[model samples]
Target: MSKVGAADPAAVLKSFSSHLIAQLESRPVKDDAERAAAIAVAKARTESTVGVLLSAAEVKALVAASTAIGVTVRQDFGTRVTDADFAACTALLESRALDATLALANTKAGLSALRGVVAKQGAVKAKLDELTAVPVDDALRARLWRVLEAEPFDARATVAFVMHELGGADVMREWMGTKESTSLGTHTEQVIERYAKERAFHDVKAPPGVRLEPMLRWMLTLHDIGKPAAVEHGDRNMQHAFTTPVLVELSKKLGFSEREIGLMRAVVDNDAIGETLHWNVNRDLDDAAKELRALAKEVGMAPGEFFELQSLFFVSDAASYRFLLERIFTTDERGALTLKNEKFEQLRARVAGE
Candidate 1:
């Protein structure tokens, strides 16, 4: 019935050591002196084991817990534990446990150990959620815009900043875990910036009174929001494009008009238009053009405007994957996918004529 955090480190360590001694006592120790020696060694080993796994924040929490229980822990582990010490002890323990566990046919203990590891992961995720739960407001949004302007290439951090502003840090973390090499935030940033530059240069057409920049930004930001949900539930087949409804609902709550939400959702649904163009350009130009026409109709965009928006995203998305551009493009030296690319130019001409 004792509270978990109320115990001092000395008491906790003592209890932990006692548990180890009890487990050891079941083993074939020779005499009372041997048992006493075993207990002493076990205490040192147990302390050395847990000390290495604790992070700086966890160590600070443990120290505070110790202080609350009237026990000083400053001199106990030299302020911090070394990684080598922890790793060595952990390897020893794991080797012993593996040997013993493998000796038995019924591997319930091994299963239990796996479950414990999973439980620890859950605890870490909970802590992350708590730490990232900053309230989204106008101030946070402004700060995010400033950071995006200052560090345009730091897409991951900028996207994290935006997610944090939208109160979606947990979602962002899940998405980030699934995409080790990809940066949704950076891709979105590049897409918006590319759209802006194109709109300034070309006669990219859109509906009357519709601001392209804000619409593109909103679309790109929430385009991949559903990715985390798809990843979390083991739904590997779920297309992230289908998640635009979530963003549409969110925009409604944020006071965006129905027409604005429709435009954003259209962009999201057609976000992968660039990928299709990239992969299918050589094999079936006519097929690619037909697909674009259908996507434009579905998203309620004119064929010309739809092609322009999708081309902007296509070029920017390719640019964002600079490291992987060689894999994406066949004859690219600098890995820059520009409007001058023959395939892209061909697609543009075909769409413009339509």
Candidate 2:
């Protein structure tokens, strides 16, 4: 028998199918043939082959079971389960169960529950704990990548992945906060989506060797990772820029190499430079150009590459600012960074060297 309270994927699937069949049978179908046809139709609609009519209570129960194992069900699931719903729930459970099981397997409470099963299998508790402690499942990684790719701009999804997959949601929550105005998580998501849209519009490409999309997503996602620590220390003057070193170190624990971590750090640091240049656009053009060149060197980017990076970061960051989004980028043209203010116009001219 399986360990008590352990999430058995097969059992879960069986239970769901049973509940669905029961619900379908209770419905007003004239005959077994009619019922089978109805079930077939429901199954066709769902990505899951076993799809059938489900009651509201059944849907809720399925969702609760999935959630217990750390799977997030975003869809309503309705009174009937679709193929898409089944597939989504199944995938979620499959991925989340591995991590949850591994986490549970490493704990004392988990061991106590598993004592009977382990004794039957002649497994040593210490060895089992050691095996499960690492918790590095490739399937989980793949699922998270899919989530990021599909919902590139979703802050909640991003946070959920980092917290559940990477094991640090509480810390991330402190950094992100609840309000949009002060939330680092909100700002990061806005920057990533805006940057992505701008890059595609302008045909801006990433540096030759870098995988641009994933790199940008990872960089922007963790750019403000150090904010909570800064705030905790009462360092009101702390900018996310000043926390690059900390971020770089923390990222190492997340499996980033030195080179990758270095690139991320440079991007985070340069974001501050972009912010400064953005604010000082109406100042001397020559001075701005000089600073831009210096900033480029500091980040080890060529002049042209730096310009592209800065423009992407500046525009994206600006778009996140409520004041700037409303007052400065006022045009209705999609993907156009039109400036309504004279200062912004001057800044644009300087950046363009016009």
Candidate 3:
């Protein structure tokens, strides 16, 4: 006669962890011990099998749970299956089999399914814990990622804001600083180069006696400076781009010249026009190229001479401004040609005539 024992923690943990624990408990096992082994071997031919060695405590709980639900236990070590193998087989016995004896025979196959569930439970729990430890919901994390990719906020401010709000500042910092940083946070030199290229091309022709290069650089830089500040706001107000005037005020306090302040102000107030203009027009330039040419004509300056003026405005706008820059300057068709001097001249003459 089999003796009854107290429940084992490990055994209960495993059994309770099953997705079908409630159902498993209600079913009863049919065959006795010796007959169950013969059936397990018969069914093992078609099933992918595994062996398990249960602790003595676990064995007792298994017996008790199984017996409470009328599960049959077969103790047959004589067959090719080892004690470990037979223990695994015993786990497979189904209590609700239509043919009670057949359930004992298919025990090995049943064990194979149970093992799969157990392994899956172990792995899934580990993964879930890893995600939870980050202290933010996955959906919220994904939203933060979208904001990062948008680069809609100031770099430093955005980083600080995200860290304060979300709890994984170090990882985010590493990601932002890495070579894999998004376009806005990517290499600063490349940004300068691209800004230079676009600024050199705004409008049909460089205005007579106007310096284009320096002015354009300054404008682009200033345009994006407020992204970090705006990110901190983290609201639908979309006030980052609107705060250019404030930066102008700050620059004046910092001793920037009146003329330099105007350039910064222009960048800050770029959106104030009655209507948003096309990217390449003389009046509503989207990026540095048009702005440089416009400023040069307005001030009767040249590209190189205006470098300091441009750099002042450029650096102040910060890295977050890339969002508007990309949208305004991007061509609808990939690889479209940007305006050159000749093209600029033709367009200018036509506009002048009109």
Candidate 4:
């Protein structure tokens, strides 16, 4: 029976829907894929009904996996690039001479000298194919190396291409199989715009080179997958911990090193520590570091690596929270960090208990 005089329009709609559903004819699902998709949606609806609202981060990660990782079928699934893109990428890499234009310098000796390097590159690519299951082209490899090698640190080329490959603006709750910690928008350019500026991108640093910047940016996007502090249901760090398997799954697909995965976890596992330290001021810097060092050890990072990686992670993360960390600490020429402050008072409130 419909509620004719219900005070709420929504109550009337619900009564009408219940009556309508009882009269609807049953239909079989078209196929297994459709059936599975329906099941997944039903499960998600049930969960959302129970009130742990799927964080934007969780949805982003799941959607990327579904689209690109073969977890679910999509109408646009087979849109990988063809002919000229691959050819051009291949030609540029093989043609560009280490010395300038390999073709021009080709005495027999010069060509002979380059053979070993070329062969070694081929061997590495073959191994990469076996590991990643995507017969990635030399062009993509060279471009990624170039991005990592670019001075002043840029990843736009690779990130943009990945955005395209992962459905670009269309499917991007996030593209590239990761989610942003803020804004939860479909675009990632906004997040990139917010990142702090530092010099020394790829153009090849002697030791601690441009790799760190891109890696940090890439994984920071993963840090808050399901971790929106505003509407989040539970502990943020714990939720981050719950998402580690998803992180590790994506990390393995991307060919990240174990050390790098550990760094990602370190950043996510303790993301809010800086804010807590600033607000409470119960622990001094040394005392606070002891807590973080323990976390670094649990993640199997060296104290040195943790100190360097997490400090950068801290300042970058802190800027949004106004934790006053970026105010004092700064990175060196190589992007290694140092807390170059004599003023302890700056880290805490101007007056105690104020």
Better TM-score candidate (2, 3): 2
Q: What's model 2's lDDT at 84?
A: 59
Clashing pairs in model 4, backbone N/Cα/C closer than 3 A? 149-202, 149-203, 150-201, 150-202, 150-203, 151-201, 151-203, 152-201, 153-201
74-156, model 2: which lDDT tens digit per residue? 22244565665556445554565655444545665767878865563322233223212335566865665676567435656
Model 4 Cα lDDT, one tens digit per residue, 1-354: 122222432222222211111111124434556445444443332211111123334344433433332233111211234564344334545655434244445655778988886765453343233323444455755554555445554435444544443222222342222233334332233333335442222221212322466566666544444333212333433344334544554555555667677667666666334543454544465555565667656655555455545545554454433234355455667764344643333332221112
For residues 1-354, what per-residue lDDT tens digits would candidate 1 score against the true structure? 112233454443343321122123243434556446444543464543232343344446545544443333331332245785545544655766755334443466677788876764453344334433455456655565555445233435445655655666555545433334544455555555554444444445666556555555556666666665555546643434325556666566544567677766665665344544454534355566777777777656777778777766555545445543445544335433454336666665665564
**Order the candidates by TM-score, highest first — what do you get?**
2, 1, 4, 3
- Write down the lDDT that model 3 would get: 0.39
State the C-alpha lDDT per candidate.
Answer: 0.52, 0.53, 0.39, 0.42
Model 3 per-residue lDDT tens digits across residues 188-297: 33454454344433332333442334333333433433343344445313333324544454334333456655644544453312122333544432343455456544
Worst 10 residues of 3 by lDDT: 17-26
- Looking at model 1, the pairs that clash are none
- Identify the runs in model 2 with alpha carbons over 4 angstroms from their true place: 1-144, 149-155, 175-182, 253-260, 271-288, 298-300, 332-334, 340-354
TM-score of candidate 2 to 2 decimals? 0.49
The C-alpha TM-scores of every prediction are 0.47, 0.49, 0.27, 0.39
Supply candidate 3's per-residue lDDT for 37. Answer: 40
Which candidate ranks first by lDDT, i.e. highest? 2
Model 1 Cα RMSD, Å? 22.0
User: What value of lDDT does candidate 1 attain over all alpha carbons?
Assistant: 0.52
